[model samples]
Target: MTSLVSTSHLQLAAFALGTVGWILCTFSMGMVEWRVWHVDNTTVISSGIAWVGIWKVCFISYLHISPGYKEQFCHKFSGYDSFIPREIYVAQGLLLIAMFVGLVGLTATVFALRNVYMGIAHKTLITRFFLVGGLCYIFAGLCVLIPVSWNFYSVAQNQSISFPPSYYMPTSPAAQDAGAAIPIGIVAVILLLLSGTFSLSYRFPVATNTTVNPDGINLPSAVSEQEQSQEIRTTSRVIL
Candidate 1:
């Protein structure tokens, strides 16, 4: 007989994890605040504290004289920071695209699970559809990964030493670290990959009974022709 319980749990788990990753990635993409790290300025009056994101940047002042948030302002990319790291832009676009693609994948997976009992043909169709959706998840993860990775590297290099000269860096003494979004994106990638692998690993259950149908054929006959011939010869010898 056929059973869905065995693999259903695993598939559902993978789907749930992938969905969580998707939500995190979406949040990260839209979030334009809280960068990996900011310049560690000693003086309270000094304005080095900043929160940066892929789409926008901001400067926060926490001067000692006016502690408790006297004034804080957020600003968008003004197209003034050197040549503007193109990687961020690319990442932004990719993440957005991934979100949409992942949506389609999730939809396919849900429907595929539902149609599992529609016979071998339907099951095969579901398997293929799920695989395609998994591919989309993977692609979307990659899209999120590229930009996050590039940004992390760029920030590290800039913070480590003056490679592109002083002007290229974000002000001076600005330390860098991995942002929250980076990890979120990484998690999403892992989940997406797992979801895809699950889809590919799905195996159609086999039955010992033979069935003859145009669209269906139970593989591996119960007894091969050679085995049948040998059995017949043994029977004749026993009768004699």
Candidate 2:
């Protein structure tokens, strides 16, 4: 006999967390503040603050040409730019892959939950979907976690990056710190991990097909139990 299992509340919570995490991950990736630099140089680009991300670098000068005028500029990382650090390059690639994988996991989770709630598929098949989605979410979280941790470590070690003349960024900064994006990415990874764990916790409920006849006579084996289950499910839906 087939049985339709209701979706678990924990799975719903996992989906919500995973969705939020994926969005935050994408936001962090696009933000150009992975690392912050403050420059005190007065000769060129005076009172400048720079933001370096995996994809690009941006700079803002409060007192560049005139005290009343503010200057802001950004430069994208070129494919052949050797000046970019290894960690940043790795972050760029890994974060992109993470976004793609997270998207896939989110899609899988949606479909799996829909199937379970609607009783569109057998519990075994739906469970497989949940497992795949959970694995994908975990893998994506790991991919992003590696880059975020690596870059954060580099910042802690006082890493520096050289900029071309056009970018007008100082090779060294008076003060350097990890930017907002770093913490955001870390939080996103944590959420994704929790989501995957919760999703994986889902288990199928036990089912039994044994039916006793009131006449103390066994039902004929020629009658399919699955058909009866389907008929009962249809009748229940109609009554509801």
What's each prediction's clash count? Answer: 0, 0
User: What is candidate 2's lDDT per residue for 52-97, written digit by digit as tens?
Assistant: 8889887755545434446765678988999999999898899999
Tell me the whole-model lDDT of each prediction, alpha carbons only: 0.66, 0.83
What does candidate 1's lDDT look like per residue over 55-157, in tens digits? 7654555542333545554445544554456776687688889899888878877777777643334556767777876787777778777887887787677
- Cα deviation of 203, candidate 2, in Å: 0.9
After superposing candidate 2, which stretches have Cα over 4 Å from the reference?
1-7, 62-70, 209-240
What are the TM-scores, per candidate, against the unseen true structure?
A: 0.72, 0.81
State the lDDT at 237 in candidate 2.
100
**For candidate 1, what's the RMSD?**
6.8
